[model samples]
Target: MVSSSSDPLATRHSTVSRENVREEDALKVLSAYLADDMRACNQAIIDRMQSSVPLIPQLGAHLVAAGGKRLRPLLTLASARLCGYQPSAEQQRHVGLAACVEFIHTATLLHDDVVDESTLRRGMASANALFGNKSSVLVGDFLFARSFQLMTADGSLKVMAILSEASATIAEGEVLQMSTQNDLSTPIERYLEVIHGKTAALFAAACRVGAVVAEQSEKEELALEAYGTNLGMAFQLVDDALDYAADQQVLGKTIGDDLREGKITLPVLAAYDAGTEEERVFWKRVIEDNEQTDADLPRALDIIARTDAIKTTLKRAERYAHKAAEALEVFPDSELKALLVKTVLYTVNRVN
Candidate 1:
């Protein structure tokens, strides 16, 4: 039952708890378990790599230890537990699989930093910044290969297929983003497609593989897949929002880093659509042209504010968050299930 103080969305829309306080508690419980599981997974990857080059292991650990939310592994572990599969001692196999997911994710980050020439990640100097692009690229390759080897040990051909396909999609997405860079004329539909490949594919697969690991019914598996895909979309949308809305000190990157990188996000897309012909011309020169002066930043911000595009993007993200929670209705009530729903909410609503 929901408490009087709870938000309607948190209660009326959920098969889980109605209390925001209770949901917060549920998130903490799941977060604690997630931390423990992730620690083990990290150790397993480190041990498997066994690199002779000390810097390889050290740099990999540095990135891992920087410790973002570990949301992917949490989704895997939580999904399995919520789906009426009581974990046994054999849970390590699943943890190992989860670790491989994180490894793949990390490898992508290492490569992404080199590709973007990013200097900071998670409030620390990015690997490419510290280790140079060469070391970062090679180490990322090592992690990618090691992740595949670990996945092979599971003996689940289905899991292997999902992960391998996701890896390929991620690469294609990266290339698509590369192709779209600095193109002011790029369509919103194309941007969504790129994000689906780059971000949502792995998230969807992570949740889907959890259901696979638990041997859930096909219906439940598809629901989880939908849930993960929507959640991933919402997650990325919020990240894009923060790119514009957040301060540089808080975001751990420059306020206009995406603009500087020539990556047009949803806010820019919305602003562009709402802008006048004069404003559009300005964006073309500033966003698409490399020779333009820094004088364009204020005007871009002014245009985004005038269009109220951030508010629109936030609403869109909320719609997906609602969809993510609705997908969980097929599952019976459980703490694990509640955690998963809260995760969707938090991912969309979070400032960072």
Candidate 2:
């Protein structure tokens, strides 16, 4: 045993790193990989999306140009490399596939903001905020249609199936989550199902599509898929936790955006389950009845602290982190594989 205490990647450092791998360093690694891969992804997105409607190209270009972490594309490129796909031989086929993943994700975000009536995204005014909801929704649909066209051009039935299924699952999960907004009784399992569908399914598909494009062995594809799914689940769990635990400046949104939106996340769910009768009534008034004072937020925060919801959720995320690392055992040990696993740990463990 290397002793988890000495191995930041091995230990569940949900709050801080035990080893010297600071958050900045981890972000630097991810940022470098994203920069290297994004130029190709952007070109592919642009080349495939030239359109008759001028606004279609303009909106798509703006969204693409608006920077994001580009996590999905990076996963695809890294998985392909780790699985022994040679760029010289494939000639950037994997990069094209990765761009497709990013387009689909961006399209969903555009529609999601419209549906959620969100004003800010990626630390700036959302498309729905600047251009009316109608434009955002229509442009989002255009992106989806364009993404499918690009996927079919890839000529891999397996890749098509994986991405198509993920698109459908994302729609279903969004509906499921919409149905539960403000319903206090929504169980943890249902919440998990929603996140798995809405988020993890796409992440898993991104990696699996890369494997398919590379014609990797079925076992290797399965490993990559598992890695993607687990990492995604961990990522979302941490995101939900951070909504309550982090400050507005750090989170890039109003603190308690979930609460304001009446979105009942895992921390809130755990706190409700662990609260007293009085606390339960408070949640009902604030979260359910939509009648709450400013005091409610601090009270809710107190309840979460009392229930240890943050810690509990962190532990669950850590389990998924370990599972994501384990999924990569089948791949030959290499720098790419090590970085992939490290990124998973860093994503779930980061405070912001």
Candidate 3:
């Protein structure tokens, strides 16, 4: 979602400092750094997504064409490059592994849209909204199955075990989120746990597999995994903040979709924890009881505005972003490594 603006990751208040690399232009930076690798990985995605069943490819292509940042797969490529994985003609295991990571991410997205009952994705009609929940769910399962095929083709027991465990953790995170819905008293620790599994687990695995494909030392593998984990945390934390504050057109979803669905995020928790007695009662009614009216959103916004919840959440995201940067210290100084650090900055700084 790069804009015409020079600093694409700029927010309403300020622009990201671009002293090292202008990683603000995500599409451009990714293209410049990992162009061929990404093209191969995308082809692998297209090749593997094909099915005798027309609807499978049709539905899969719809979302793929919608143009997400493709950050997860890109992480695979970046990590592989960081670990000095040169693709030989006979073996481009990193490409297939990257595609596998994307499939896992896309499957989760399809399942998530159905579970959220979301009407839109990336500003377009969601697969579930267009293709029906049954189709979305089945295609998601299909994608999950396809990912296993790719992993098996790679013939690495460790990679398979890592991704399989991540998949299970993702499902567990989704179930935990469902259970926590409409509960304002959900602990911040529980919220972090949910995100660690739902979002960060796959990121960690995606990064780890790149090092595995590179046959890198265990230290490099662990370092990349930590980087991806911290970056994922920052990314999702910013996403939750955007749900409360981003412009509708830029965010591509309703600003208060989480609240409308009775999902508790840090903003809601901040407001609830800091508000007056009457304000707490409102939160109990709107979030806990799932009783909401048209006016409730504005009231919730006001509370958030007063409590500075979005800022607090963004501050927490910055902490994770810093950790992500710190994790990359294991890698030597190089353009790719600098870009990786900039990616961390972009995660927390991005307006979209």
Candidate 4:
């Protein structure tokens, strides 16, 4: 057994990795580590998103140009490399598979903005905002169809099953969230289930497929799956917290954006549960009743601060991040393994 004492992944995870951990640093390191494989994935994504319909590629290019981290596809590529997948350049299908993950993720983003009536994505005008909702929704469907084609080309029944299930689960999660929207009474458990379906299911599937291609043991596959799930949970929880607490300049998103959308995040739930009766009334007005005013944001922030809602939400995120790190214990420590562990820590601690 590799002793955890000497392993940097385990050691830093137990100590400094949890402090001053920047998301950008992890992105840079991971980008460097997977440089070659990532190029292939990028090229594949570019090639596959092309459509004879000018509007399809035009809109797809806009989204691809907007450029978030591409974290899901990176997870797929990294997981495969960690599992010793070293196919010859000609045999490299990890690129196609990773591209497929990105397509699904991109499709969901397009669909989500429409559902949320969002105007901005990554600090720029959203696809729907620029292209119109009808165009955005149709292009999103186009991306989904493209993703399925990528999956079929791979010709792996197991991979098809995993990605398809994740796609369906994402749709179901969005529906579940709609039912709970603007209801301060939404159970924390139900909220968790929603994130698991909408966000983490794809993360889990993305990681698992990498292992599947490498023909790793079931034990190893599950470990990576667990890692992805918990990382995703932590990622989403931190995102919720950030919407209330993060620096606007760094993340290119404004505080209180999610609250304005009637998102019932952990901080909102905590404040609702811990607040005085009068505070409850305020929450109902702004969030539940959807009667928010310009002054309401400052008031909401004050209430959340008083109740330690942001802090509490972040603490909850920490628990999930720790679990994600622990899930990697089955893999012997390598640079990739250590970076993966660090990525888990970054998920929870990120300011942006």
Best by lDDT: 3
> What is the lDDT of every predicted structure here?
0.77, 0.80, 0.87, 0.85
TM-score of each: 0.89, 0.91, 0.95, 0.93
lDDT string, candidate 2, 1-352, tens digits: 0112332223233353356454334534654655656677778878877889898888777786677778888888878777777666456778878888888898889988988888777667788888889989898888888889878777788888999999999999889989999999999999999889888999999998778877888998899999999988988998889878876664465567788778878998999998899999989988899886888788888899899998888878888888998999998887677678778767876663
Model 1 weakest lDDT span, ten residues long: 8-17
What does candidate 3's lDDT look like per residue over 263-344, in tens digits? 9788888888889999999999999888899999899999999988888888888889888888989989988887887787
Error of 4 at 282 (Å): 0.3
Arranged by lDDT, best first: 3, 4, 2, 1
Off by over 4 Å in 3: 1-9, 12-23
- Backbone clashes for every candidate come to 0, 0, 0, 0
Candidate 3 TM-score, true structure as reference: 0.95
Best by TM-score: 3
Minimum summed lDDT over a 10-residue window in model 3 is located at 13-22
Residues 282-310, model 4: lDDT tens digits: 99999988998999988988998999998
* Candidate 1's TM-score: 0.89
The regions of model 4 sitting more than 4 angstroms off are 1-23
